[model samples]
Target: MADPQSSQLPEDELTVPRAPLNKMIKELLPNVRVANDARELILNCCTEFIQLVSSEANDICNKQAKKTISPEHALQALDSLGFGDYLQECKSVLEECKTVAAKKRKASTRLENLGIPEEELLRQQQELFEKARQEQAAIEQQEWLQLQAAQAAQAQQQGLHLQPGMQPTAATGGHFQPYQVAEGIPQHGAVPSLNQPSSGAGQLPTESASNQQIPPS
Candidate 1:
């Protein structure tokens, strides 16, 4: 039967969930059938038991000027409430929990887990950085050379002369050679005048010719 006082407590105070309580009861008494009212009674009793222990532990904590309840305080509360027969088992469980927690903390802080010494790690990082820097420098140098070559080629194509070192190939559409005249072409100063006749053609008489040939005329 459920306790009258537990039944009178507010729903919010019943923190023990019913489903786990019902499951536990079934596991403990598989062949025996339990009523729903019995299950409700068990649920309420578990909640009341937990509340009683926690309240006593809180009081013990306050008396010791502590704001939080530790596991020791809970154990003390259980002993004070006349459950000393369970103390040894609870202490063993608490020690096991603390051992597991310490192992986890130690594993988290161990430097050996990284598989490399600090100096070796730093050396590897420096090597990677140097490799990347060298690659970047080489790329920039190649790009600069390409730009200079392009500018030189453009100048040559525009008929501007360049030094031997700066000359580009004909494949780049540039002509760097000096200008030349073709064969059989006359020089600028040796060209003949159009107003003068050829030497073998009939000629007009000059003033000297008129003074000599007048008797024959």
Candidate 2:
């Protein structure tokens, strides 16, 4: 028989956590309360049991000229170590693990399982990318057109509010220029020149006006 103390790892080097050990102890004894020392001893025993099983599994693997100890070797080690009563439960757990692993493998290869060739899948992906790019470009173009329309509307609104005689000019640094009056056109509110004759000022008195004046005398 191996020394129990020799198989025990140091507290600092313990792989099994105390919290899970405590929970398991509570679950197994439900209403019964366990002491701290009893919990520590159970934790150490669990770790030692794992080390013993692993060593036996490794020996069984080496006897078969294998470099790695597989699940089968572990089951065989349990039986050889007089723990044959756990064999059925361990097998059931092993089967559950295998089922989960199979599902993961299947999920990882779903695309390949679809039966589509790699080249076809790549071509379809490229087509989808091209369609997305075209849609984005069209959206950008529509936004640009809407922006141009808004600017044009703003310019027209501003033009309607301008003074009648003012016109926009590029030469005046984006300012308005007053409309220039043409020569010979009379300006509003200007005084007439005294030296310039009016339309009837140069004409003599009419004949009828001269005859009427002699009669009155």
Candidate 3:
């Protein structure tokens, strides 16, 4: 029997061997027996499914500009690529996997900061993982609460800035106050007598010669 804890084979050698897959099928359907050819077909199908899932996961990593495919990417790919019909059924398991992966990453970072040797860190992995998990959860919760508070404050400021008639222009077509011209300024097409051209098209009449009364200068 293969040692379950042994390091996985390199990607190049990671073919889906038939025995384990067949064992799983049997466990699921103990009373049903597959014929030799049918068993081969099932094995092929299993290999194809794995290939599809791996390709989808790799695509997800590429989308995120990541060189390595992580568990989060895999989960997102599974959900987005229509393979997550069973997602609700396995939601708890997937959440636990995410938590574990996050804790591991946090632990590794913390140990590195403390100048712990990589090998020595393994001895206290559990303790470090628990500490990291707590810290990550607390940080995330705090940030979430801060974000909510900031949004609420912004919304309150917006409300205060708005007068009674204020509303989104998109939601309710904007209202325009009557366009009031300044006291001395004319409306759009109005011509003020002071600015009107004199009898000679290109020249202004002398101030004393004009019909209107002029104030003493």
Which candidate comes out best when scored by lDDT? Answer: 2
What is the Cα-based lDDT of residue 72 in candidate 3? 74
lDDT of 2: 0.82
Per-residue lDDT of candidate 3, residues 16-127 (tens digit): 7777878888998899978889887777777667666677777878878888887677677678878788566557887887899999999888877999777776868978
Off by over 4 Å in 2: 1-11, 111-217
For every candidate, C-alpha RMSD to the true structure in Å? 18.1, 13.7, 23.6
On a 0 to 1 TM-score scale, where does candidate 1 land against the true structure?
0.41
Each model's lDDT comes to 0.79, 0.82, 0.73
* Candidate 3 C-alpha error for residue 130, in Å: 35
Off by over 4 Å in 1: 1-10, 99-217
What are the per-residue Cα lDDT tens digits for candidate 1 across 119-176? Answer: 9979999999999999999999999999999999987667687654355468667755
After superposing all C-alphas onto the true structure, candidate 2 shows an RMSD in angstroms of 13.7
In model 2, the Cα lDDT at residue 129 comes to: 100
User: In model 2, what lDDT does residue 170 have?
Assistant: 84
| Candidate 2 lDDT tens digits, 43-121 | 8789889878988887888889887779999999999999999999999999999999999998779977898988998
Question: What's the distance in Å from true for residue 123, model 1?
Answer: 29
Cα deviation of 182 in candidate 1 (Å)?
99
